[model samples]
Target: MYEDFGEILINGGNRGLGLGFVKQLLSQAPQKIFATYRSAETAKELLELATNNPRVLIPILADSTCEEDVSNVAKMVSQETNKLDLVINCVGYLHNAEHGPEKSLRQINANQLLESAKMNALPTLLLAKYFQKLLKHDQPSVFSAISA
Candidate 1:
């Protein structure tokens, strides 16, 4: 069903698991890829990958929490291609300097929980809200996410 699939969007695809997904997708030699990062200067690994695969990889600076960034990216993608075959959301806000996942109910804090929820939830919702139309509906299209 995905024989026509080519254009792909990877959010938060700068480092760690997100970067790993970028590598895996590159190995498949897709027609085009749009990878988003909050800060381009800090995404050295992604930048290197894009350098090595300039034609297939396109790095975009975007903050998942920011609606304007997401909307702007949608416009950019619209300029590049009419539709995307897949959208993979890899942004995770699972921890902050103040705290992390608690082992027990008592160990958890309201602030950390809210922070984690915002990070994990906001991006996914914003992506769909802004980019859903960019995905082909008649043909096979996929929206997926990763977290820990």
Candidate 2:
């Protein structure tokens, strides 16, 4: 699918499946790669992996729930690449510790559900909205998310 390469933007590429995608994409020799991470510190490993690779770039910070963050990423991507071939929204989180996942139907509070929806769903919607211009006429401009 990536045979004729162009820039690809990956949100939440700090680790796990996102990181794997970045690593494999790097091997494809795309024109450029823009990966986002919530915490720069958490992305050190990935940063190091792409340290000497000129084709990789990490410009967006991971805050998919924030409109400002998403907008800024879109702008940055537009400035860096003429077109986006693929956009992979890999931002997600399972409630942790004090706010772990709601197990029972009765335990599903408004706050928990809202938080999950924001983390799991909203970003993709926002990304499509903000990046619509950049995706124009680009056939197979993929937008994907990994959900549990």
Write model 2 residue lDDT over 1-148, tens digit each, in one string: 6755477888888898888888888888888888888887889877887676754655467588898889988888877777787888888877666687767888878877888899899998888988878777646677777877
For candidate 2, the 10 contiguous residues with the lowest summed lDDT are: 53-62
For model 1, what is the error of residue 5's alpha carbon versus the real structure, in angstroms, after optimal superposition?
3.3
Clashing residue pairs, candidate 1?
none
Clashes of 2: 2
Q: What's each prediction's TM-score?
A: 0.89, 0.89
Deviation from native of the Cα of residue 99 in model 2, angstroms: 4.1
Tell me how candidate 1 scores on lDDT. Answer: 0.86
Cα RMSD of predicted structure 1: 1.9
Model 1 segments more than 4 A misplaced: 1-4
lDDT of 2 at 93: 77
Residue-level lDDT of model 1, residues 1-148, one tens digit each, is 3335588999988987788878888888788889999987779999999999987899999998888999999998888989899999999856667786688889878877777888888889999999889884678899888877
